[model samples]
Target: MEIFNNITIVSSEILQEFEKLSSSVVSDAMDILNLEHGGCLPHTIRPLHNYTKTLVGPITTVYAPEGTSLPVHLAMATHVQNRVLVIATDNYKSCAFLGDIQAHLAALNGCKGIVLDGFVRDKDGSQGLDLPIYCTGTYPKRPGKADLGGINIPITIGNIEIQSGDILIADTDGIVIIPQAYASTILETAKKKDASDAERLKRVKEFNYNFASNIHDFTSILTKDVAEYIKKHM
Candidate 1:
């Protein structure tokens, strides 16, 4: 099946550029673009392992039932190089749908990371593989494996529905998704703003700048009326 739907494939070169960006920068870009919720998945869907590096990639998704992770295996069989494997487990809490085995396979498949709406197990072993696994949490038991699930289809993570090929960026702060249709625009906007954001951080570190000065006018991200209202209030 064609995994992409009228989406321009992001090259590894571009992915490298994105890797240098934090989820916060991308989230800020999404906020400026006014993508609802800024494409954030949810606060609950988080990293399973502590990672110093940011996870960046287009996602290949698996919609798994509460107990079965069969679709993940099938999806992993395909090309996942430099990709993030996202599994929607329907918010099942009874058990972990991912563990060391899946993490190992994903690493072998050249996947850059994993994101699940459900729990995972084998934390020690999975951590040993050095693959970034983002999930709701960890559960020791998963009961249903024979049940069927879909692969490479739209799946809901938190309240947001994520298309299979959406760009995913995660870090210590949180996770954010860039929809395929808006991918290029958001990426460009984020890349451009990233330079200024770095400069802003530098000023903060060097001079204890609180952005109390309105020189950059960070309120530009708001609607004209809202920005005007804030300006008047401030």
Candidate 2:
């Protein structure tokens, strides 16, 4: 199914604003809003040690075989400005799905980062690179076959079905996949949550306690409001 009519560009403004919000805050924001965007698996696969920037952009999904690299190359060749390349492999055990070379290319193309739900290589090689990369694991051994995958098709990562143009947000906490059509809404909810969090923090600071029980807080925290908000908005 078509998830979005057109690619809605996530302006650097929103991205920058998002970056200002801590990963814990963002996770809490998603939780407060009941947005299903985080909780990626195999947390051991982390953003390369030298990686500093949080990556955010629409998806350019790829699917490839274990021993092939063409799909990776194709995804890079098609990389549009601000896009995040996501790859779902038919074989998660075949080989590394990404490496220094592909990541460097993606960075050169104005892409933000990569979310390879399978595998990728190059920890030392990934250092000093300007891109943020996340994967299931790193493979010291090179990919076995090079002719096995496709790009720009629907694929599932972390067992979540991702379509082309889905919004991918990666930060220290993990990756969150939002359908492109809902990117704006997610941001709106995030914004709202940020406001709420600010108030929550204010109240806690004022109360000097671990919990809030004041009537003002009971109405303001709205932990139960998420369900109602989604029903009203989504």
The clash count of every prediction, one per candidate, is 2, 10
Please report, in order, the local distance difference test score of every candidate based on alpha carbons.
0.77, 0.66
TM-score of 1: 0.82
TM-score of 2: 0.74
Model 1 misplaced regions, further than 4 Å: 1-8, 36-38, 205-231
- For candidate 1, write residues 1-234 as lDDT tens digits: 224332226667667777888888888898889886337877898888778888888888788875787777767767466678888888888888877887898898888888888888889888757589888988888546674777677788777788767888899899998786787778798998898767766654565346547733555444456778887787
Runs with alpha carbons beyond 4 Å of true place in candidate 2? 1-45, 209-234
User: Could you give candidate 2's per-residue lDDT for residues 39-118 as a string of tens digits?
Assistant: 24345456766556666677777776556667777668765457777777654675776678777778888887777766
Q: Which residue pairs clash within candidate 2? A: 63-150, 64-149, 65-148, 65-149, 67-144, 67-145, 67-146, 68-145, 68-146, 97-119
